[model samples]
Target: MFLFRWPVCCFLLAFHKSAYVWAGYDVSEVTCSQGLSECTVADEMPLGISESDGADVQMVTAKVEVCCKDNAPCTLCLLVDAELSIHVGEDVDKSHSGHDTENDREEATISTASVTLCYKTPPTFPACKRVDFTVCPTELKQKVAKVSLVITNPAGVSFSSIVYIYPSKALHLIEVVAPSLNEVCSQNLQKSIKDCYMPTVNSVINQEMNQVELKFAARHKVCIQYEADGRCQSWESKTIPLHSVTPCLCLQVWDDDKPRRSQSCPFKNMGFLQKNVWQNLTASVRHGRMNNKGQMLLWNLSAPCRLEGEVWPCRWTSGHHCTEIEGFRQQLENTTWEQNSNVQWVKMGVFEDINLQLSPCVMVNLRGGGLHLGPFCSHHIIAAARWRWNLLAVAVLLVIALAALMSCLRHDFVKKWASHSFRGGCAEIGRKGHVVLLSPPDIHDGFSEVCGLGSLLKSQGFSVSVDQWSRMEQCNLGPLPWLHSQLLHVKNLGGRAVLILTRKALGLAHEWSRQQPEALQAGRGDGNVPQSPYSDVFMASLCLLLVDKRQGRTGERFLLVTFDQDVVQPPGSLPEPFQGLHLFQLPSQMKTLLCELAGGGNRKVDGGKSKAGWKWGILDGWKLKTKHTTCSQGAIPTQCK
Candidate 1:
């Protein structure tokens, strides 16, 4: 009985040792290759051990790997390795493996375990190759997602684990820089589209992310309303071609489907710069008061973008020699906008009188792009103040010189006026009522006519001083002394002095008086009283009288006349002094002589016929009787003695 009992017990024990038992399963470990989760998964997972069975079993772990493409959605892949544990009765073969089991009847038997994944925070995520998680959410706190994973065993029991998935850090410091004006004009379409780039610091930080390039769209148009607003109404929305000479240009950039803010008016200040340049150039050329002393011209310009260029001030000399101004050639650096310190003050040397003009020019290279832009200069040259002042001074000097010359030429007229003013008043000859008729020598022809002329003048209210009237005085004072005294009296009275000129006296005007008693002749009116002294004094005065050039062919205080018998006498035949005097033919010019003694020379008499009617009648009768008496004496009046 012992032997049979031992065999059965032993078989039962062996069966129990060979059989597997089912127990509650639990996930020992989980692994996720993606680092965006709150729960950590180990690299190597250790399978759980069945305590009663005394056998080790390994449970497969899963790796949650993520794959993404470009800026599109990201994918999350769950690769699971699962093994099923099954429990068999004691009759089952014991050679299945070396693993032993306990007496628990429940077991997980399926070869495959079903895994279900769902998100709690984020409702949906893309599948293996197409899954996408939020990289950057609107709220930073919502960037994390709660994911639940369940592993179902063949025993119908479920094992679940919760994981928090936080999205990976995304690119945050990205920026787009637009192309410059130089690139816009000079670059081709393909190169221009690729010209836009990220900011320097941002591109350095995100080296891998920087591979994602941006595209640009440029619109060239005029900025009509730049002052108040940027209103560029372009007719066509399509991109226009750009050139260096294009006017009123602007630019815009695009990033992917969305466009970035545009950078317009790359050359907005160009017009203002050009206007100021012209003004400065014109001012530089103009000559000032101290232009020859040299000066300085400052060039201050601004730009929206960086620029590289050269500038120079030039001078054109009298010989058409063109040369740059001294100390004014400059190479431009990266000049920026709105910086006052960038002003370049150029000093110019002394501009000689031979300099014809001056100007300045600027050569612009936009953005240091090597392409050369046309030079800008002024169109018109400005006249200098110093030159204008010089011309005015010369003109004034010429006018002054001309006036001086004219004054010198008319010195006689001016001298007379000055003398008259110096004397304190005008001469009152007619008002003095005094006249002197110095008689000719008694040997002269027309001696009676000479005496008659004095009488005729006496009838016209003149106090006539004549040798004939003054015979008693002449006989008492001797002829020479009396004659000298009468001449002196006429000068002191400011009176008129008349000398009756005859053909014989005029012919002997320049001859010396013969002092011999035989040469002396008695006057017909003198009654055999030899008047040699009177003749000598009269002839000497005639030779001394000379015409004054200053007074223009006339004397101030002398009157000369010839009788009708000497009518053929020409003024040129007389002495120099008498030539300027009017040769009056008697009776015809007798009224004119009266007008002369009345103060003005040969001027119109307002009422000579009525006021001097008696004088004219007596003078006409004397003239008619003298002519008749001479004709009766057998003397032809037309022929002078």
Candidate 2:
């Protein structure tokens, strides 16, 4: 009988303890699958009883749980020691049914008691047999709930514990204050290109609020709906990193099972650098008005995003110098392009001269990135009046330089051209006759002056030979023999002879005359006596003069001429045969000389008879002068008519 009774008592004790174990559990002590409870334990709070010194105090341990299972309603379960001695105040019973006299002192009678719960204030469940409260799954959607439980004993002793319950579907948004896009770009500039990432805009969102929270999931996205004609036209979604988030874009949170929420937009306000947004931006540039400060470059910026800041930093680079345009930023914020205004016309900078050749550009703050809204270039602006004046000045300088060059070459060029034209029979001479020019070797540049006279006569239809050009032939044939040959050739061609006389020539002639009288008296009148210490050509000329004078020959075959630069000796100072001949000064008496060379004695000649009746236009002013005067003769001559 004692063994059977002990086994029964053990079975009853085991059953009693197991009853409360299912209702009340310490989640830390037990795994979720170890329990007989069908609900999955979402959260649990344990209120462990402290050791009590007072015998009146009841020993109690309590725990609460928010539990749910696969799409089912959530329940708030309160678990407590079922063996605790507790009774409602009004329903207390003093009588006790003792299990046995020996066991009555060790175990207290289990009493029926009520537990009350209150949540969200004013909503209370009182005197409940079971401590389970049914909660709709949608009621606690992704949120936390705090519940308060109150247990009262028959003696009016009250015990209470607060339980924080989290439902199975509860979610929380962890707010993270991220760096702005500008700061991210700057900090990651040193990173490798393979590691560097640039975020592209997914969609343009119109946000009504300035701030909201983002819900992070497997796929983080920004979604926006564009409207047209009062209806939604299209939906745009973009994948973006957390760093690229801004208040202007809308966020959508979703999962594979179901879309948790949609239209969560205007993300939490992340401070931005307005200057950086415009740094990589593109815009149109225009020239600004010129003021007292100078000419300015105007940047017109119209963007969909908001631009608001105290300053916009930029650099202006020209050549090797870079200048910060900080003043323009202040000017931009203060001018018509106000803060929060999307459209702005900003004055980039001022330049002293717009016509400078410098190609200045505006550099935005984005250094490594490609050209943003600009390096706006500056162009040279030249006024019409100033350009015309510069052109005129250049033309005047060219004309002056050309005149100076032509002046230095005129004498030599005309001399060579006239000689060539006469040789080619292309001059006005037209192969008319021949003439010989005789010049004394003692005067300065006397031979060159005689050559000039010869060239002019050659152009007037008279073939002329001067001693300067024949010096090589004169060296081969003696000067006297050469002079004789030239005279014979002139006589055969019916051409006259010219003696270019100067002060030196007359002096030499006086010396020769004085010596000739001594020679004739010495019985040597054959003209072989040394007359003067002069060139053989000069002595030969004097010998010819002597022979003509002694023979009493008239000086019709010979004429005397002088250049403007030479000192013309008076005809009375000349010898007998030379004094009777007409002494013509060239260029002034050139027509008269030509007439005499044409065999017209004392005849007046008008050279204008062959005029082409056309004036030279502009070139007439540039015509070369002969001797001290220009030639007055026209194209044709009437000298021998």
Candidate 3:
């Protein structure tokens, strides 16, 4: 049985001899037998791989081939570029020289495997070409993706070092940096759109995860609405919407009030980076008031005084009810206070809660409106104070100067009044006169007759001397020997002497010698004189005697006139020397006594003309008449009528 089994196995083994699986680098060359054509190796031969487009993958026959043993009928099969399951498999038989096996149930194969990926002779990538890729879904964790890249090179050659890909989270972040991703993400189109939603990534920042930052610089229209109970309206709402249909759509920060106030709300989701918010927003901010209070800077003032009309009211309105406001502002020096219109008083420089990350702008809210506040300069305060001082000084000086001027004027008026009172209003008259009139002085001395006589005499071109009068009695002279001297001197100077008689003088006319001669002896006795009971004959005698003496000095005229309203005393009804003197009828005070003397330049009078006109005075004869006239028996003669 062993011999028979051996013979059958030997026959089967001899029939089932398999071909040797030989696979290695191909080392073949085409040759010319007759030594006419040059032989070339496969490496030197031109494969279509060298002439391929940068985007295509053209297969080149590798230096791998299948070989069989001598004279043995065998099958030889070869495979090139063995790869992973993810790759599109390409089975290429470089050569087939072996025959099929005796069993022929399964085909025999041989292949060569090398370091090959999806690579080209001259490797390059498309705009968004994905290179190494891997998806790692670790247990109980978000799946992490990994990707790697190779630099596209011009030279068609493999790199020396092997490449590797590690798991990373940055693969998702890389989408933002891709060239294809940049084309779709542009800037904001409408003013209502959120600034951050429109990405303007100038530079990539975060080398770390959450810290990946961007630089954004642009302006946005923002309007804010105040919460009913909030203290600050500006701080709460950043943007306001104009379109009523879309309350969230914000087109402008400020708008014409004609369409009424736009709906405003808090916009916390603005995507723009706040890094450049100060720089971008500063230009649009104006010098504006928080309340009605003027936009004023802090210098030094009362903390919470009522500004009234000077500032905007710090209040808020809801329906018909206005509420008080309590708020703080951000500034160089932070302060806080209440508003008056809002029911409390507030100050200009006030601040709120602060931190290191402060922005350049602050919110200022008042009753009627709210706005963002920008920087203001308070440096002019010092200079303004100086100006105020200067103005005050000028005003004080003006008041002082005006007071001094008024005082000077008052003193001048007092001095002038005193001078007028003391000096009286009359000019001084000395012993220089061409016509002299003797008359009695009265308490109320100024009379119309005296003034008319003086004026008439002056009009006739004679320098007349009468009484120089005043309201005071300083210049008054009572009858004295000096008066007698004045009358005699006037006669010596060829001046006229006129005697005037009033009722008082006429009643005591004859007693003139007894009363006045003693007064003359006393030489201007007593500034005042008492009235005396004297005879009219005595007065007439004295006047006659005086006239006789004065006429003896020169042939000047002696005017003796009786002013009696009761009777017309004719010149012939008089005593001896006075009988031919100028005698005329004179009504007491109604008319002036004018001695119708001579023509102009005659300088003479009718001393003794009664009914006969222009009779010259008998000077020697008047002395004879005065000697014959006696007084009282011890008295002067009464009268010869």
Candidate 4:
């Protein structure tokens, strides 16, 4: 039986070796022959066995032929099942008669049943070309998941270490422990994972189970309403957070026992930020009020804010109706008065109608209800006690002062009267008599009038001469020789000379009298008289006043006129000798004065009435008068009359 069992066992062994049961390829010994060609060898021999145990073993070899079109590189692989067990200590001779053999072998015990062997010339494309990909469901939680990919070339190669499957989480954990490991492992894992994972284990655990819940508080609105019972009731409501799953929730409440005023509320004290919160609350209340019209009571309670015109009365009686409370009319009028009071009162016209009834008064009623009269009303009444009395006294004094001032002005305007008499008979002056008007130089208007008077006197048949004595350049009387000579000549010719002196000329005469006393006193009737050159001129003319008119009073009489043309009256008394001079103002009525001097006669002395009449009369009268005076009463008139 031992002999028969041995042959049977040998036969079974031979069958097992020929049947092709899978023994995993030796990965360490595998290699590519050319480029991509594949080959397999089966040998009926044991590859590795303990020599001492004498166990039989068999070996298989896969030859990978690698080739590329036109020398392009390629890849080759050999596959085997891991379920075939290989003894730990195994060796086999792979030498063949005509084939070169490079042998390296290893046996491994693996948990999974199948494994593959690979042989590759460095691939023409990169080995397991680095692939970048994106995955879905951006958010994720706990679990191991699969990711799929389609590769370009997946022929005879079976994946082992070349292609690996890993949980990104496990790889991450491993990376924490072994830092030197390629960071690509963790990076790939993160790329493959759908969810973000917390780095700390504790944080991840906490986040996975419990989430935080947040709650917000209420915003409150408060309103006060007047009740019929004369009590103010306050209604307060608060808005709850809408996100909370509760509706119609009362978050805050307040009750009022007495009437409350809006002004009395604490809201007024709350500054800007708090007031904004109140505004927000009121806005919500207003929204609620709008939505629930039927629930007016509730709406009022919700309406913490008041509308601009929404004040309500507490009671409803006949006299205390809402209308009786004043429909903004009284408020408007009061506001107008308050704003306008500061404006200044304007008097519209010279006599504005003022109301005494509306005027402010000082009198007051006594505590016993009796009215006080007159100015004794108040100690502070300044107008009645002091100002009125002072004003009346001032008015009376003003009247008396005004009357006295009028009397003084009247006295100034009244004309004063003067009396005088002539000692000599009146002279009948002929046209041959001459008049000389004198004036100062600086008073041009006065000098002009003197010139005009000379012309006027000449027209009236008098030989008139004007002496502008004030025009003399020298300050001394010696320069006035021509004036003295002319005066003497006119005097010798028996002609009259009128000296018209102005205020300035009168002043010069006083100065001349002081400087030239002899010339001033030459013609004085009495030595005691104050002398003036003007007096000398007058005396010379008086000596020549012995002419006679053919008609009227006839005598050796002369008119000596010393007229002052200045507006001021002469100062002090005139000398007795000068007093006899007929002084008059320069006649303002020139035509009337001329007519009076012409004796109202249209006819000339030597001819009938015509333009020639006045000229002829003046020439004839001069001749006749000169002859009549000089004839000594008996000779024929030698000069033509």
Q: Best-fitting candidate, measured by lDDT? A: 2
Give the per-residue lDDT of model 3 (tens digit) for 1-641: 43443344444333322212222323221211110111122221112113211111122122111233354321212212111222111221123334634222112111111111222231332111112211111110121111112222212222221222111111211110111111212322223222113322222333222122223333422222222221322211221111111111112232222222223332223323221121111111112344655442222111111222122112212221223223433332212333333222234442223221222122332221233221221223223433554586458546755775697597794565355445532122122235655554320122444444544454443445553221111111113433554556565655556655544443334333444665533322122221211111223334554556555622235655444444235545443334344444442211213323322112222432222122222221211122232221111111211
Worst 10 residues of 3 by lDDT: 632-641
Pairing residues by index, what is the TM-score of model 1?
0.25
Over 4 Å off, model 1: 1-429, 443-445, 512-531, 547-554, 601-624, 627-641
lDDT of each: 0.36, 0.39, 0.29, 0.27
After superposition, the stretches of candidate 3 with alpha carbons farther than 4 Å from their true spots are 1-433, 442-446, 468-489, 513-529, 532-557, 570-580, 586-596, 599-641
Model 1 per-residue lDDT at 234: 28
Task: Give the number of the best model, judged by TM-score.
Answer: 2
- Candidate 2 stretches with Cα past 4 Å from truth are 1-431, 520-534, 564-566, 601-641
C-alpha TM-scores of all predictions = 0.25, 0.26, 0.21, 0.20
User: Candidates ranked by TM-score, best first?
Assistant: 2, 1, 3, 4
Q: Worst ten-residue run, lDDT, model 4?
A: 342-351
lDDT, residue 489, model 2: 72
Q: lDDT value for candidate 3?
A: 0.29
| Per-residue alpha-carbon lDDT of candidate 4 for residues 533-563, written as tens digits (9 for 90 to 100) | 2234444332232112222322223322223
Query: Candidate 1 residues 339-409, lDDT tens each?
Result: 22212222222223323335433333433335443232222321232254347646855675577558657
Error of 2 at 217 (Å): 99
What global local distance difference test value does model 2 have?
0.39
Clashing pairs in 2: 281-373, 282-373, 429-461
Query: Sorted by lDDT, highest first, which candidate order results?
Result: 2, 1, 3, 4
